[model samples]
Target: MRREIKYSDNYLIKQLPKATAYVNRDLSVAHISDSWLNNFNFSSKNVKKNNILKAFPTLTTKWKQDIDYAFLGFKNTTKTDKYFDSNIDECWLEWTILPWFDEEENVIGSIIQVADVTENFLLKQKLEKLEILIAVKSEIAKIGSWEYNAVNDKLHWSDMTKIIHEVADNFVSTIENALNFYKPGKNQRRITEYLDQSLKNGATWNDKFQIITAKGKEIWVIATGKPLFEDEKFIGIIGTIQDITEDVLAQQKIKESENLLRTLINHLPLNVFVKDLDSKKILVNQSECDYLNLTSEEIIGKNDFDLYDDETAQIIRGEDLKILNTLEPILGKETIITLKDGQKNNFLTSKIPLFNEDNDVVCLMGFSMDITPIKQKEEQLKLLINISAIQNKKLLNFAHIVSHNLRSHTANFSMLLGFLIKEADEEEREKLLEMLIDASDNLLETIDNLNEVLEINTNPVQEKKNIHANTEIGAVLKSLKLLIKNKRTHITNQITEDIYIKGVPTYVNNILTSIISNAIQFGQDISENKIEISANKIKGYTIITIKDNGIGINLEKNKDKIFGMYNTFHELEKTRGVSLYISKHQIEAMNGKFIINSKVGKGTTFKIYFNEND
Candidate 1:
């Protein structure tokens, strides 16, 4: 329903006295002032001639009896109303009704005045809640509040405060009594001085002091006070004080234990230090001073930059900042530091971040432990390990080649001798003898190959030269001419004469000879024997690709053993299988990569990558 808006009460309300309002004994809509009408959203056009209960449905008609009683010459009647409005939540109203009279002193009507007590009522409610909460907190925490009013010259203390002071519940408080409660010595004088200066300069203070209670017992307490102000003018001091005797004693024990630990650490032989977020040194022990060959005074307040060279200092500072940001500990950081005297020292260091109660990194604490002797021992072990690895590797390869070759030779001899024993003709015996000689020769060649590998490893750092690839390929081809003619092999060489790579000449020749020979021997199976050699430079490395139409090795079945010592996949040709293994090692030693990619029926492709710098 749309209610009609009205403002007829505005003119009549403006004619009333400051707060004049009188209701007839009916307790109907009394005259309301313009201020009250504007403030309370009331209007004569809306509320006049209406009962009080109907105008503001929150009221009771029972108030009309009090209005009638007040008009019967009784004293003014007062009442407070508390109710909830749908729009305004909680509302508090107070009204005072007095007997209204004419000049003839006859009681006529009841004059009523109203006050919106919402603010004061809400404040009273909050204070009640706070008092209950304070009571709970005080019991649990042993803390209390107090205030001193300089103008009234009175000191007020909460119940918790009185209990802390060990005073009677009804004890009369005075400035003299308060001051006297402090121990007759420094506590009294200090508190007196603090209060005088605090009042004079309006300064705040927070300190721990001992107080002599009413029972003459000495106890420590933390007292904090701030100058109370009204309109920017200092009035008095008010703050909280907590009995901190137990906390103070615990802290003292902890401090004593910390001192003992610090002394023990300083005596031990470790270089320990503390630094702030800005990398400024905060603490350093005797060992750190001795290590730096400087007094503590010289080392303190200095950062890594002030003590070490820029590069080393920056490396250290970076780690420090990382710890500060992460609040994490970094352990076992090893580095070599060169000092101002040009003496290099090896140190194993660690850092940890210090934090406050809020878990924010307050500072960083780290220690540098000299590990020169341990590092020296480590280097020695590494050198021995290197020598052992090299020797073990060469010995293994030698054994592999020797075992395969010796077995081949012995088997050939056994077969030949058996054939000779069974033969009746002298011609057959002579042929078997010749075959034995060939077997022994192959064994000797295998031994020679082992020797060559030994030499290569003995001087692994053999000096290399820039050699032309096409010339090397041509030489290998010419050397294998008889085999190539036997196999009916066709060769295609695409290497430029000027295209160069760095490698040992003997090794390079051996690699090309072995690969080319394999191509010719295996390509003999194909109807048309074919081989192609090409080279290109990509990304500073010379890449050589060798392709051939041949019976490609089935890498799927033998992939794992392809470069292993004495490992062979083919049975069509007599082989000792040491070539591929040694070639791979030698190529890698020269900072090159060796790759072979092939399929079962498709031909084989070998790619070699040679580093230009090598």
Candidate 2:
């Protein structure tokens, strides 16, 4: 549109508000509005071909910088808009200049528009002052403020707000910047959605969320905001930012403490459970789950009736109800439960009522300890006490026998010696002296036997060491080789070389020697007398067997008394029955055990059991 630009025909431009003008590239005035003439008190001659700096000399270097930037071709288009006072005084006008161009893309002139925004500018300045005041107050109170302008796509956060967010001093605030400050995962998503929703529905919100600072420090902040509205149209939002990091962390610590308490309850070894007052389901620990043989999901919502039979359930429910109703703590109550395996186990339980905020019982918390082992130990102790009483009784009988037998021999010897001292015949005196010598030998033998028993009892118990049964057996056989040769007895060793047993060497050797010697002496009349020793491992225990093709006891007549002291099956001249008794006791003391299997004509098999190496 090639049209002539004229200043005389534009009457409205003369009266138009603000300083309006048209200037050529050379700063020659093409036209001037009456508002500009009035503000600057200028005529056509003064403004025409005038330097822009000369017109606004008070602008200092700012005006010169704008002229240089526009004239040096550094930029094809330029706008220098700033607030300045007019000659009328106290009147601020924002002068905006736009460089104009011709059709051939030549810079010909410029359009200058000036607006009197003094009132709007002052109001904004007041608002900025209020914002700064709020920031100062909030900083002192540990609070900050933010505003989002959706229409302008701008964000404004107070200085204190930026500081609270742990951002740099020069950081430009934006919604993206705010969102980036929040920690990832739930907190970020939640806050982003909350802001979006609040903007959409114009809803007010006050929320706390977690964030990571620029220093990678975790912080908690409380954000409170309301929707921004202009003429009932939603614009964006404005809000306060608070650094509630310390308070939030303290609350988290309390929550963690509560969780830790619950974790402790779950991990307790005892069978722990809690029953809800209104609900039939009971929460139970892992121990309780295993006891019931039910999965956590299976038994979590069911009552006693679902887990047990009617009768059993009633028994439990009644007691639980009593504890709940009475609000009394019941502890260490013994109860018997029949397990799914058809085995009964005893439990020591404690039941207490759990109260709600109103002090009303809302649940029953129960703890049960499996006391089966304790009960078994009590029974074992009672049996051991009886056994100890019997042992004492036997010791008393032993003492009486020793006293009576020794006393009789001593009295007879003393009487005979007294007679011998007065005897006149030498033959009679010699007979009395021989009798005293024999009595002395008997007393010595008795004392020796007593000493052996005492030594066995006084020996300190020690842990069984791994010893080769073959080596010990061989040593025993070697010691008794002379006896074997004299009797022409054959010995057979069939024990596995690698099958060792844990035992004391002395006790094990004594047992082997005693049994083997007995067998050899009893087998004197057998045409082909043989003693066999064998060992094998069974059921985590080592089993050793010694069988002899010698005289066997009539089990029908002497089964119970075969291993008893002084109770001999056959009248073998050296039958003390002490060997078998001592061997049995010794084997048991070492944690190994013994059993004798015999038949009247068939021979006896002595089996020894030793536990395997741990």
Candidate 3:
């Protein structure tokens, strides 16, 4: 027989590790474990023979009723019972109530076993909350889990997975049916390969592809699987499936948009380029590469300095930096560029700063249009306009001369002849004849001047040669040496030997002679009369300036008619305005300009602009 050992109920109860107590039918505490006293913060001497409910004042009527059921020969237990001690601290308790029997086998009281299970109960509650949270997150993300058991040929889908497949809750799915959900052809074939690989070699797979749900709706899904193994034996595969239809479609649209933009940029006729903050080229369209006579590979990542001369590069880089700093756009700025082939071109360029989502300038975008053809056309139009203006002025001058000068001369001749006819005395008749003769000579001179003006207006200068400015001035001065000496004028020719201009030599000489002659003729009667000639180059023009200290007219009064034919401001009888008018027309015909500056009692300065020699 097994060694029989017996111990008193109190001894066994006291020896128990759990918080235990034995109570009588009257709900009195008969025995209490050391753990019970320690758990309840009660001393053994204070609660050994006391009523259970009285000892544990926190025990409510519900506890008494449970004990009553045990007294009636019923066994009752509470897995989680809430209790609060005198300190108002909450805990979870487990209580077991069983009927106790005496030697007669009749029920006496109940044996109550109590345990403080707050830690385990709280941990179980936390696990339940976590499961609920995970379920909520999975539903929101359109993600679901799945498992396949190879041995049993069984498949399991989470509720979310079923929902993603657009199936009812009661629907059943096998591995084959689940594979069928993938769209036919490439998607299905790819998924089948992944599954077979995982099953054979215990591999893992992650793929995003299209699928057809049970509702016959086509959608995109990202599926992932990892082979499951137990003791080196391949059991099955567990994986996740996500409904990524919206995300995939959005990505496709974005890709299409990018491609469309690229195509449009490449096909555009305008040069387009993008630069980073460092002023390095990051992007360039086909037109930009063509404009620079470079390939995209050569141009990309390069700054202006790498492709252009130092001066040109500095200018371009400066503009880019300004745009970047100011976040302002430069629009329709006309620029001229000289290419490698010695060809010059014009462009209308615009640059704008590109911004990020934060509204800060991150880079810059530029557009340049080849405006060379347009610029050429504009130059031609300007030439035509100048020609038209010259022609119009010439016509107006001719009409005025005919209407006023010619008519005046004819009227004078008619008057003089009528006077001669009316006169009877031989002396008077002879005087009238002399007057008519003088009038005829005047008429001849006027006609000659008019013809000269008309010739200069109608003939456009075609052949022009480079004439040294100093040499031409010397020639004019030599021709006017006698006139200058007679006037006691001091003349200075400051034109350098290297200064040259493009014009007909004869016209250049004539223009200088006219201006110098006027200086000599209009000077005050003084031995100190002075005239100075100087020439210099400015931009594309050679400017010849003639300054003279002479009896200048009041330009405020005579400016409009200063160059008019036969309009003289001085009282000198030999002063004819034809010289200056002819000089002005000659200069214009040679594509030159004449400017005059004068003040009464001061001096006159004449500036003639001629195209500088190549």
Candidate 4:
């Protein structure tokens, strides 16, 4: 049989599996278990009977004090500390130090136990870091989280969630009280529905709605919620809320601006259109559609080539291309278009390039206006200017004529009277008296003619009627028949009876009588002097020609003065030099033209042009 061996208390303590050590009152190591040696990387000879603080140089002063407290019979104390082993690897230690009792229950020393808690300590640090990260992110994004407990009828709001609501940190909120933070009507009702759906059907919800903050200010928020479940039973709801007031208001303003612009352009009277880079129509206002005689649906997506002739389309396309390439605007470009109905219209058009954020031409905007009426008015203005210039020249001639004729007649009368008063011979005195009387009659006749010229000048417009040229010419010839006989002049009237002219009757008779009388008077020196009259229609005018073989005028020398008053070509007692001047004025007043062809001895020809009548 084997001998029975007894195990002592020290041997039994050294065999313990935990890292345990027994120390004396002086903190000297009395005994240590096998795990204790392994944990500290020590052997029995190095640690037994050695001071515990000296054997483990890593133990801090606080650990020594706690061991001393255990010697005073205090309850067990536990502490955790960071440690670096011989290899400098990081470790965490949980030390439990308690007093050891003798058989009489008196404390003798302390027993210290240690555990390696490195894994648990690292996990706890990670959890703390993650919580800090979540808090920072929530604050930056203006987002917050909340949870509701149906069992306790309580609501939990995170720190950021309370801040979002503008509530105190110590604020206590329940589910009903939390719902009150939403706006009164629609927001509150919607939130309630969302919660109900989440609770009953375990659904998730996301919505954007309005809310009232604790300060009684309204704001916009985006909210999301998900039902919480445990063992297939609904328990509560968890969700997130974010403040989005600025974003929501900005979107609203953008929409309102778009609507206002649409209303303004649609109601304008000018033609407005927008086109893409390809010259295809994108947008057009009502006025543009009306001008094109097409609806918006028909015009959109179409180019100039689809709506206009090839020539017009090419012109428009060229302009659009220039604007896009140069990024410049063409303003007030005048264009003319001939419509399908053969009517021509004028337009003032403008086109400008539209740019994108990168300062690139993306599209073009155009405006057009009809300017045909303005162009017509300009043409009328030019015609009026020509008429004004002609009237001004006529007035200047009349002024010079009046002043010159009056002065010449008065001087002649003065000299003739002086000769009559000084002559003693009755025959000579009577001759001077007759001469003075003739001068007086000439002056009176001159005054009457001047008065007629004044009337014509002041009233440039005359009432015109159709007069037969042949009958009028016959009447003039008969009135001057005695003079024609005395002058031995032969007059031939070849003006056809069917010919008619538009003129004032008085002006027509005056013109004919002056020309015929002049022919008869000037032909006295020529034997069988002949005058011929003829008429023919040319263009829009009836041209009457009067040819005479008489004392012809030197037109090259007196061309400028031929139609001037008191400018007589021949030295004759009856030549007053007023008839041709008056006749020319009358012709112009009737909107007719007077042209003269003459040579010093070859003869003279007068051509009068009047409007041709039916």
Q: Which candidate number would show the highest TM-score if scored against the true structure?
A: 3
Ordered from best to worst lDDT, the candidate numbers read: 3, 4, 1, 2
TM-score of each: 0.47, 0.46, 0.70, 0.57
RMSD of candidate 2 to true structure, Å: 21.8
The digit string of per-residue lDDT tens for model 1 on 1-614 reads 21221467545656664444656556665466766566566776566577655543566654666676787978665677785554757798777778866556676666677777889988999999998898899878889888888889888887788888999888777767877877778898888888888889987888888988888888898888888888988777887778888888899999999899889879977789999888988898888888889998898889888888888889888888788777779998898887766778899888999989997888988888899988899999998899689669767867766786788778888988899899989888898889878888877877786776767666755788988898888889999999998898899998887799788787788778887887788774655688999999999788888998787888878888888767877776577577887887677677788889887657789988877785
Tens digits of lDDT, candidate 2, 534-614: 878878888878888777878778877765555678766766676776676676567667777777767888887876653
Indicate whether candidate 1 or candidate 2 has the larger lDDT.
1
Number of clashing residue pairs in every model? 0, 0, 0, 0
Error at 160, model 1, angstroms: 3.2
Model 3 spans with C-alpha error above 4 angstroms: 1-10, 55-59, 196-206, 227-235, 250-398, 420-441, 467-501, 512-562, 569-575, 593-610
Please state every model's RMSD to the true fold in angstroms: 16.9, 21.8, 7.2, 9.6
Ranking by TM-score: 3, 4, 1, 2
Q: Each candidate: what lDDT?
A: 0.79, 0.76, 0.85, 0.84
Please give the lDDT score at residue 245 for candidate 4.
88
Scanning candidate 1 in windows of ten residues, the lowest lDDT window is 1-10
